[model samples]
Target: MHSRSLLSPLARAALLLALLLATAPAMAWGRLGHRLVAQLAWDGMTPAARAAALDLLQDEPDPSLAGVANWADELRANDPGLGRRSASWHYVNLAEDGCHYDVARDCPRGNCVVAAIEAQAAILADPARPREDRVKALKFVVHFVGDVHQPLHAGFAHDKGGNTVQVNLDGRGSNLHALWDSGLLEQAGRDEAQWLEHLRGLPLRQGAGLGPSDWAEASCRIVRSPGFYPGRAKIDEEYGLQWSATASRQLRLGGEHLARVLNGALGG
Candidate 1:
């Protein structure tokens, strides 16, 4: 009574595997997303900014914006001391305040992403700072700019930015934060080049002189939107179809914003 029964043994096995994979939860943006953001920023940067960034990265292996885009994320494994110190710099919990970012209330010691972006941009802009320090700042700027754009990174503190909000995505277990971070984007099945091409087709709207706080606020608003957190703990195909566009838009916008930050700090 079933179509699968008509197939050969190997054919049915392949069909079953295909269905499983189609529903399997793939890792989202993660390194790939970061690199996409970095590459997009690099492609959008001014010639002067690119040159300055290159000079700063000359001493490193793989000296490109995309090359070091994930440095901060890997700091825990590569540089544990700095990693521990900067652990909180990647996000801010603002859902408690109606998605409003009050510097004093949200970021007490300049530890959150919004503050981190401002501080790193300042360091990158200062000509007198040690070159080594400035280089690190450059890397941080690239990574944090991308982080601030991720909705959950600017999401609620109650659930640790949705990291604890578990859900069943496709047929596998995942979390809300992970869904935004890389899962939704991964569902598109576009490689970096494909994503770049897709993003390039979208307009890079000019922000009205907005900065990191503004960016974080925007992401917070997305989290606060209706149904951002699914009522049921199950993520269906339609969920990815609906939210993937927002995630891609964020990645593109993150690229544009990172370029602006680098251009101002390094373009001289």
Candidate 2:
């Protein structure tokens, strides 16, 4: 029998909830979006930052930033222990707090993406830390930056970042969270390079003056916008046309933010 079968009913339920929380927000941008973010960050990074990043990642299975861009999401299968510990690092719940991040209320004990990015950036910047540890931190920073830009990732927590909101896409069953994660991008029918080209053409209006918390607040604001949430449950082509641009903008912003973070941490 499975080891979980040995637990009492209450214990089983608690375990299930924990598992759910861990996996729920982790699906921020699908692999394609994540890779695109990594590539964009790479393109924007300074020479010193790129060299440092490559040095830290030298011993990893895939040594490039884009190569490890989705590492955090694959942690459940590749490294279960770290996956459970860092799951909450993917998102913050600020919907109830006026889209503002109050550390004591929304991020108890530094568990959300905003704090996670700050913490990982610190580790990556600390030359005294072990090379292996800093490498992992770099991966987390790349991923969490992308996660924080997903509008629904910082949306109302009652809906668990819209994971609980059911919707239909071309008659297929799906959820709001899933739609933002990859649906809109996939509907564009572009490959990774094509998507990157499309994203690059959009004018980036966000500045480097903002930090992680500010980014989360911006995402939350997007969620609170009128018509941001579809009036109907059907995700038609019109719906995709209206929202995919928003998703693209977020991807562009996420990439720029990551580049700046890495430049600060790794660039001399």
On lDDT, the leading prediction is 2
Q: After superposition, how far is residue 54 of candidate 1 from its true place, in Å?
A: 0.3
Q: TM per model?
A: 0.88, 0.88
The residue-level lDDT of candidate 1 at 8 comes to 53
Q: Cα lDDT of all candidates, in order?
A: 0.81, 0.82
Point out the worst 10-residue segment of candidate 1 by lDDT: 1-10
Runs of candidate 2 exceeding 4 Å displacement = 1-26
The residue-by-residue lDDT of candidate 1 on 1-268, one tens digit each, is 0011334544443433343334322222578789989999988888899999999999889899999998998888899999999999999889889888899999999989999999999999999999999999999999999999888888889898887887774356667776676656555656688778888777896574999999999999999998889989865655665677788788889999999999899863
Put down candidate 2 lDDT per residue, 194-259, tens digits, no spaces.
788788887777876899999999999999988888888864555555677788889999999899
Task: Tell me each candidate's RMSD, in Å, in order.
Answer: 6.1, 10.8
Clash counts for the predictions, in order: 3, 0
